[model samples]
Target: MTLASLDRISPRKGRLSHTTVFWMVFAVIMALLVIAPFVLPVFWLKFLTEILIWGLLAMSSDLLLGYTGLISFGHSVFFGLGMYGAAGALLHSHPANLWLAILCGLAGAGGAALFVAYFSTRLRDVYFAITTLIFAQIFYVIIFTWTSVTGGENGLIFSRPHFAIPFLVDFKFDRYTMHWFVLALVAGSYVLLRRITRSPFGMVLQSIRENEARTRAIGYPVDRYKIVAVMLSGLFAGLAGVLYAVQNEFAAPDFVFFITSGDTIIFNVMGGIGTLVGPIVGAGFFQLLRELLSRLFGDQFPYLIPVGMVFIVMIIFLPQGLMGWARRWLNQ
Candidate 1:
């Protein structure tokens, strides 16, 4: 083969090698996670479950920010809605059916996503973000003041529903079972999002991200795409919230605030935006860092000061994020 031909082939080989290594790492990590609930202490198991929930939320944010180049500061709205929807179902229903609660959560989140997308998707850049933020605040106020239904600031607590399938599997959820269930759902979501990002629809979203004008000029319905993207992202975020509500046995207004959305953005920035796994890793890292700092400094010391410092450093030095750095290393 000609030297030029060999040079062209070498890059392909490198890409193949990188892909292989990525999947191998993914499989190993998943295996460890599967075993974690059984081996880890109860406290750590609960912590890990929280990380997975937050990671799922981060991944949902990534679907818009990383893939579609849409910055949504109101994902917490969808999340909170999901939590409340589940809480409402479980609290009001006689049997407290797990399926009913999950369906309610999904419906509430999906409906909210559609409503938000219809209006917010028309705006571009910072306007879109502000619109989302406003929507979130509006929901927050309603939930906080509506004491008759939502429990106001106290939120709503309910019993953990039994995990059941029709004439198939039925059981109560202890910490271990809950952890495994959350892990399964999160992992499934990761896989589904990964597939979506590689599909033709994902390509169009990326094109829109790169140049909205060009994508629109190419005959694609840019507004429609953006709207769909927002809805999809919101649905996933809502799912994360539902899982969190289930695990914690409560739903609170604090989670619906814009601050949660901001933290999700931070997770995307810390993890590497475009990569599916990055946000999850970012969530885990962020949580672990906060835990460590809080332990060292105590609650009164304001651990966020140190956490913010580290985030600033990462932004300055590792702007592409942890996954981006890891990719570069693997390519080398």
Candidate 2:
């Protein structure tokens, strides 16, 4: 618009753009990840694994909430489906291993999403959320009531992590190796989500989120995209559930419970929803805080008080969350 502003923005012919700096920062983060396993404690490492799992779940929710403008409270149903699917697979006539059971769980979540999204996608906002919530509770009740199959309240605790192969004790109870496994999955999910966010599909979802009517008028099949996104989200959430079941070698009826889903939503909001990376940060923050509080305060009255204060402070001061604050700080 003006000569002074133009001169400020224009490159002096050879400098790297701001995009280059962003990558540089990301590269440094990757380097830190490479060294994390050896540095982190065993307890914290396991906690991080749970955080990564839920972080991915929250990321999937953000895909619907942030990118597609579809907020369905029933995501917990898909999450539960995956959990039970994995557990049930192990109980089948021909029992499945952890990996196969995980796959089965993801399939179960995806299948449920397919069945629900078919009808729910036609609605919007509260209607869609309510439909999902009802279906999720239905699934929860089914899991709760189906005691013989689900092992009832006692739960099913299978033997230790037995590899299909003969003698690989390294991956069994060695916290170090187990942590590496989790780290690899977490890193892989992060890369996949980044690509999803940058892909054409991601852009289309964002467009739909911004204005579905205009996107549909411009010839995009908006409802179909939403359905696909929901299924995909379930796939990831189920994968997370499989990891949860395997890591614990136990499956509770509560896997598909509404409270479990609510926890994820809280984590998503706490971490800065829609940013993709925010959920991981938020999950880690909360888990770490919870652990520390349990140790320091011992589940007393003021236990939640500190955690609540932290969230309140974040909401008021850093509404966008840690990633937002970091971006601003780095830019400045």
Candidate 3:
């Protein structure tokens, strides 16, 4: 073969190898996680489950910040609404139907997303971020002050719903079962989001991220796209919240606070924005760091100081994030 043809074929082969390696590694990690519940102690199992839930939340934020170029500080609103919606259904319903509770959570999150997107999408840059922050604070205040409805800072606890598939399968979620359930949901979400980020619609989102004016001039409805993206992001965030409420057996107002949204953004940044899997990795890493630090230092030590130092170092040395660095190394 000619040198030119050989060179082209070599690059293609290299790309294929990289892709294959990635999938192989991914499969192995998933297999390990599947078996983890059986081997790990109860405390570690619960901790890992918490990480997966938070990872899902981080992935939701990545949809907006990484894909849509929208910095949202009101994701906590959707999450909080979802939690409350599930809580209300479980507490008030006669049977505490699981599917119905999930639907309620989705409805609450979807509605809030539409409401926030209507006004927030019109603004750009930091103004949009500020608007979302304000909206989150507003919702937090409402949830906290509405004594009779929201439990007035005390939050509401509910019994766990049974996992059922009509007449086919029905069971309560023990620690192991709960971990498996959460893992399944999270894996499904990652697959869906990965598909989304690789689709034609995802291309347009990246274009919008790069240059909104050009995308609009090319005949795309930028505003409509942004609103849809926000809603999609919210849907997943709400799902994460529902899972969290189910795991914890309670819904609290603290989660609705803007700080929660900020932490999600940090996860995106730390993991490498625009990569769907990055945020999940970031969540796992951050949580592990916190757990380790807390154990070593005890309650008296301000762990955030060390965590902040590590974060600063990461920003300075690995600005593209952990996943980004891995990608670069693989390519090299």
Task: Give me the candidate number with maximum lDDT.
Answer: 1
Q: Candidate 3: give the clashing pairs.
A: none
Whole-model Cα lDDT of every candidate shown, in order: 0.89, 0.74, 0.88
- Those runs of model 2 whose alpha carbons end farther than 4 Å from true positions after fitting are 1-24, 93-96, 163-173, 300-306
Candidate 1 local lDDT, residue 8: 24
Which 10 consecutive positions of candidate 1 have the poorest summed lDDT? Answer: 1-10
User: If scored against the real structure, what TM-score would every candidate get?
Assistant: 0.94, 0.86, 0.94
Off by over 4 Å in 3: 1-19
Residue 159 displacement in candidate 3 (angstroms):
1.3
Cα deviation of 286 in candidate 2 (Å)? 1.5
lDDT of 3 by residue, 1-332 (tens): 23322332243556676568768987998999999998999999999999899999999989889888989998899889889989998898876888888899989998999999899998888998999999999999999999799997999999999998988988988998999999999999998997787678877887898899999999999999989988999999999889999999999999999988998988888898777788988998888998899899887788888988988999998786787777777656
Model 2 over residues 285-324: C-alpha lDDT tens digits? 8878878988986766466778888888888998767766
Clash statistics: count for each candidate: 0, 0, 0
lDDT comparison, 2 vs 3, better candidate: 3
